[model samples]
Target chain A: MAGDKMLFVIVIGCGRLGANLASGMSAAGHSVVAVDSRQSAFDALDSRFSGYKIEGDATEFAVLQQAKTVSADLVVAVTDNDNVNLMAAQIAATVFKVPRVVARIEDPRKEDIYRALGIETICPATLAGRAFMASLESTPPKGAHNA
Target chain B: MNVLIVGGGKVVYFLCRAFISKGYSLTIVNRDSAECAWLARRLKAVIVHGDGTDLQILEECGAERCDAILAVTGHDQDNLAICQQARIRFNVQRTLAMVNDPDNEEVFRKLGVSAAFSTTRIITSLIEQRTGFEDIINLVPLEEGKVNLTEVVLRDISPVAGRALSDIALPENSLIAIVTRNGSPIIPRGGTVLAAGDRLVVITLPENMGRVIKLLTGGR
Candidate 1:
């Protein structure tokens, strides 16, 4: 892994998304570290990972210290709760002074909160509509006769 | 370019695998080390066992030089924070984030992210297509209402199943791009004929969906 110089990424959650992301990034030749509240979250990871793995509470300060985010190229928060993720971003910005930090916001209502916090956000609802529309475009209606 | 991933979801897995195939530099951040070991060994990407939302951990992971950052955790908040850190704090050139709520796409775009996607959206679209349309199995978007890619299966009820390409009048702005028989994809030509159980990939304008599907399958 050291042979190639690329971005270093850390994922906060070890749940479904966290595990999949870690495995995928590793496959892509990026250095990755995955963390989760529970050990079971790691079960989904592939056997031939391309990066290191750690199990711990991503919201805690001690866990962050162990992972060494101070010099990381990028940091990602994917925990289940929104508040914890926001706090994590605050810490990343205020304490560690990491150059980059990103957060996911599932609730469209809390978009303003995330934006006010100076963090980036992804809304799931809008994405759903877009995908639905896209699929509609490709899906021909039933019972239509075309040759 | 160096890429960073900040989630451990299914989409993240797919994204990571795609990057690996492209030979891009990659790094992953997660809370679990043991579970991620398999991926660690496969792509040889460095893994840090920690929270991505933490500033110190992100710094340690080297966010400054990353060319792109993607956040795809189960929680939308976490993905947002990772993208924020990568773009606002680290100054990463490109940032892609995942939204669990499809409604939040505008918010992501407004934040100046390079791109954003939601797994729920993709899955729902697939489900909707399968349930709402009997003849069409798959649909992919193209330009805004101008054209799209569709997958259709020919059944016994299809009127055009036994017809040659020249015999049927295709809907305006609609074209059959491919045909599959015996599970093998075949490029469609003028003389090609449609048969039962064959799958066709077609491109058509949005307004032509009703006409195209009706003419091809006879509207079962």
Candidate 2:
């Protein structure tokens, strides 16, 4: 949507969120590198996904180096493990000095910590809770019927 | 002195006891609630039930005012984050992290952690000293293992056994500090003659250690 400007992005983990982001970003004409500890996880990426795939633990600094995080414009750490995501995000922010770093944290309590460290985080539980609450508060469209 | 320790396990339990005995005020941050309860009851310290890598939890534990922070979590990444946060955000004077992978030690050091200890490297070195090479025993490692104090035992068939210390070609920067033969110790001099069964206390760079060992043990 922001013209044809291509951005270098590194996505840690190959879970649903990571795979989707990598594929979606690549489709949008961005250079993307997706990393996962298990090679099998890369199977989730669709054939249209044009990003590079790296099989290694993101927690290890060498793996991040292999991903070429130093030149990355954005880093997304979406690993299922909170500590792994946090560490990856911190390395991207503090060590590599990536312009933008985001981590998916499952624990809402960790939001303050991420904020303190200046890391952007998305928590699915909080988002889902808010969405459910909004659904309860909003009335359905006149044409819509209860299933 | 106030100390903040992150993680709970056998190591943390022992450290808690040691710090308590040393009269240091202690606070522990751990994610496991059960472990937190156990630590709270067993140790004379405050236990916070949350991840140590979390800034809120760390702040609640008074990380900013702590004299030292020890991040000894079983997970290397968690330990790294905890130590980094302690140093960068809290500005703790001293931060120590336990690295499960020895290769991560340098990375941690470069990231500004005051100290990084790898149990794997320590155990590997200990085992190597006990069973490796047969002639060279590493006494101590200095300068992050760049230099070492080594003990080389001279064998009967060693090429330098009967040679004067000055005559034997040694690796650069290597110096034989003392030679103990039979039951007496002698400070090595240029004219000192090396003998079989003599134990040579040498200081050398780690890269040249093998060469020194081979020279003293007849290349065995």
Candidate 3:
């Protein structure tokens, strides 16, 4: 949103959520490199969507390098496993020097640690509760946060 | 309009740029200073290093004075917390949240949020587009569906592909607004040729759906 050029993003994990975000971001005019160990992940991508794709474990440094994670301005770790996602975020932040890291932690309790570490984390359940409550106050859905 | 975003993740980046281009001020909040610097340097958005859910951070960032507040952190909980504080605690008038789950949209509306967008819902709609229905990929509901804006993808068999917009026998209450093709978006003109794979965004009433679909897909 900030640059004249598209933001360079690398998404770890090629599952349903990951592929959707990758394709959606690409549609939103961001440059993206999406990776996953399974070919099925790549298959779900829109045929017309143009971007980079690599097949390998996101946790492996070699795999990340191959996907050119170092050059990415932002890295999104949306893998199913919280530990792997945390590790991916660490790699993006500490190892690759990626400017920003956003990881999904399924467990809401882990958020405190994620925040303390300076990594942005999203906990689905708590966020949903706030949104549901906010909707009760307005006609159209309005955005509301808990903090 | 100036907007202060409560998070510095991908959605914030996308929305900030979009609103900024449409002439809106943008500020980003994140816990990481380096991330703040990087995001700020690129988007020219003001970056505040603090927790988005913190009342102090929102006030210090002057979020109350802004036109709109968008909380789109990876954590739905954080986004919800920030939006609520901005509303009830700080009294910020306009607020929006990203409802990570599609099933949560109705729930968000009940909470009084201005707008709630679910990535899951939008993605599913996109995936449903491949079904070969060229007339209207997704519809933007308006006034309880009294009038709606819809997108139509042009296919090879479309009867209106080569015809002028004015010549097409579109049902009353329907208007073609824009056409997006091959990644290039264009404002519609009367004589523009609709090519295969072109995505057309049209505004019309629900009653016109069948006619629109038939014309765009050359009815089976």
Candidate closest to the true structure, highest DockQ: 2
Of the two candidates 1 and 2, the one with more favorable DockQ, higher being better, is: 2
The native-contact fractions of the candidates, in order shown, are: 0.09, 0.40, 0.00
Off by over 4 Å in 1: A1-147, B9-22, B32-43, B54-64, B84-133, B139-147, B155-159, B166-173, B182-184, B205-211, B218-220
Please, what are the lDDT tens digits per residue for candidate 1 over residues B173-214?
Answer: 989999989979999787898999888888888788778888
Predicted complex 2: DockQ: 0.33
Instruction: Report the TM-score of the second chain of model 2 against its true counterpart.
Output: 0.74
TM-score against truth, every candidate: 0.46, 0.69, 0.43
What is the iRMS for every candidate structure? Answer: 12.2, 2.9, 13.9
lDDT of 3: 0.75
lDDT top scorer: 2
* TM-score of every candidate's chain A: 0.80, 0.92, 0.85
Docking level of model 2: acceptable
Q: On residues B1-220, what C-alpha lDDT tens digit does candidate 2 reach at each position?
A: 9999999898999999999999999999989999999998899999999978877889899999999999998899889778877887788989889988776776677666777888988797788766746566767667655688987888788888899999988888888998989869999899999889888889989788778777778774
Span of 10 residues, lowest total lDDT, candidate 3 chain B = B103-112
List the candidate numbers ranked by TM-score, top first: 2, 1, 3
Off by over 4 Å in 3: A1-147, B14-23, B130-136, B142-147, B151-220
lDDT of 3 by residue, A1-147 (tens): 575678999988877788898998888888899988787779888865578988877755567778888899889988787756765676577666788899987777567656755689987778997898788767543344533
Give the per-residue Cα lDDT of candidate 2 at A7: 95
Task: Provide candidate 3's TM-score on chain A.
Answer: 0.85
